[model samples]
Target: MAQVLGGITTSHIPAIGMAMDRHEEDTPYWKPFFDGYPPVRAWLEAQQPDIAVVFYNDHGLEFFLDKKPTFAIGTAPQYHNADEGWGIKPIPPVTGETELSWHLVNQLIDDEFDMTVCQELRVDHGLTVPLSLMWPGNRYQHIKVIPVCINCERHPMPSPKRCYKLGQSIGRGIRSFAGDQKVVVFGTGGLSHQLDGERAGFINKAFDQYCMDTLVGHPEELTRLTNDDLVEKAGAQGVELNMWLAMRGVLSEHVTELHRHYHIPVSNTAAGVLVLENED
Candidate 1:
């Protein structure tokens, strides 16, 4: 049967991708942020999971104000990166496992989580940036991906509890699949920073550290936090941390923290990355 080997959580700040694309990694402004991911890339090279279930939010690239689903799953045979009005990243397209995706869709529906299934979906930096950080040098082409999108841009987004429960359901679904594939789940976006408003340029290192520490064993306590509380404390965009909660819910109760990196001011955001493996 297919097995979920582990999960990764990281910030998906577009500026990080821009730094990489522009070859500015060594520059003083971006070097620290770039330095944080080499260990992640190394860890991924070792684990080499066949598939990645990517959890991220769209930033008006594919879905706009016209129509947006609170939860969406990509079932395409391949997922291409989007322009996002700044041109596409020069990376190979990510392959998809349609059969497994269909199975997950069915299971999620059965579990009472209504998800919009996308036969065609365009991925933006939110999804691809993390892949680049985790699997640099076009290594992303080697593995299949299932894009699980959460609606963090819009209001009335799924609560922390709901995202966590959905992840639990996803874990159950992956275990039920008959294929012998090794999978990794990813929760992308946030470690606290506000991008707009008078309170823009906010960064909450304390809150971000609290989440990184607590999520390992006390995720239930995080579920008690409301989106408003997250926005107030972590920053507006920090609400995206709910995506991390979902990723956490997919792992075994006891996971070993294999790697972690955190940095400040990655373009109005506090960037963070974590790799956790199931305790065998």
Candidate 2:
């Protein structure tokens, strides 16, 4: 049976990707944030997961405001990346695990989760930035990707609990798969930040810290927060933490926190990266 090694959560701000494109990791403003990734890369090198199931929100790439599903899973043979006007150069295409994706799609629907299944997807920075961060220098090409997109940008979005449950179901599905592939999950986007209206450029470091520490073992505490509560505490776009919650949902109840990094004002967002290894 397949084994889930662990999950990783990280901020997917467009600026992070652009900084990498320009090779500016050492620059004063970006160094602190970029420095947090080397340990994660080293861990990945040692573990060498064969597949990455990315839990991220789509930022108008494949799904737009006009037609967005609360949950979507990609089963494409190869996923493409495009410059969504962020001026971030597109990375190399990501290979997909079609067999595993189809298996999970069946498992999710059977488990009562309505998922929009896609055989073609154009991934944006939300999915790619974390990949580039963890597997720099084209190393990501070695692993197949399965994108699990949550609707964090629209109203009627899945609540934190719902997303968490979704992750749990995915975890079960992965464990039941016949293949022996090793998997690592990714939850991308947000610690906290608001980019528009009266609350533009808003960030809550206190809330971000609380989430980082709490999610390690007390994810249920976070599930209690309603979407309204998330917006109030985490900011509008900050609700992207749903991806993080979903990532946590896939993890074991008691897991080791391998590494965590938090920085503020990364292009008006609270940037964070967490690596959690599933308990044996």
Candidate 3:
């Protein structure tokens, strides 16, 4: 039987990745950022999960606004982390879990989740930053990735309720997959911060705490939150939280919080990391 080993939520701030690569973890700007990586890495190592079903939103880099799909899954055997006009990072591409990804894709489609399956796609900073931090080094070879791409940069995007439902569907779809494997659900994005207009540096400590609380104990409340509500509170760019809610939806209702770290000034964004325990 397939089971969720645990859940990880983190901000996909690209600068964090650069700092880690440069061994600047002790620097004032970067030291606080390491708060969650140790716990996350330990969590992954302990669970020894076979697959990582990553829930991350592309920054209009991989899937353009014109051809964006609300939810996309990578069914590829290998995924390259490409640099969109910017250059590629020093890190290498992430190899994918083909069989499990295919099973999830086929099962999700049958379950009526409209998902765009990609055979080959470049994972932008959104996916790579977290991957680099969580599983730095040749560790990627030991773990396989299944990406769940959400459209957060475009309008008429998936509503909060819709994303929650999609997560639920994905959870069921994976469980019913009939495969003998354990999987981990990683929800990557914002605690609370804004990056646009005059509100580019807004950080909502209250709202971020509330989000962490609801995601663990009362996910139903989170599911009811609208995209507009998040933008109003967390900032327009903060609506990327829809991706986090999707990952939370897959876990059990009573999730134990293992580690949490929140910090700001990483370029007008609040960066944080939270781990949810998966029992049974």
lDDT of 3 by residue, 1-280 (tens): 6788778888887777767767888887777777657878987888788888898988867788578888899988888876666554645768787776787777778878899989988788888777878877635766788999988887878988788877887787677777778888888888677777887777888898888777788888887778889888888878888878888888876778898877775766887688888655
lDDT of 1 by residue, 1-280 (tens): 8899888888887787877778898999988888877777777778878999999999988999888999999999998886677664645688888988999999999999999999999888889988887766656777899999999997989999999998988998898999988999999999898988999999999999999998988888999999999999999999999999999988888898988888998888998888888763
lDDT per residue (tens digit) for residues 1-280 in model 2 = 9999999989888898888888899999999999889989988999999999999898887888778899999999999998797588889999998999999999999999999999999999999999888877756888999999999888878999999999999999999999889999999999899988998988899999999999998999999988889899989998999999999988889999999998887898998989999984
Off by over 4 Å in 2: none
- The per-residue C-alpha lDDT of model 3 at residue 153 equals 87
TM-score of each: 0.97, 0.98, 0.95
**Candidate 2: residue 272 Cα off by (Å):** 1.1
Give all candidates' CA lDDT scores: 0.88, 0.91, 0.80
Please list the residue runs of candidate 3 whose C-alpha ends up more than 4 Å from where it truly belongs after superposition: 87-90
- Residue 200 Cα positional deviation in candidate 2, in Å, after optimal superposition: 0.6
Better of 1 and 3 by lDDT: 1
Best by TM-score: 2
What order do you get sorting by lDDT, best first?
Answer: 2, 1, 3
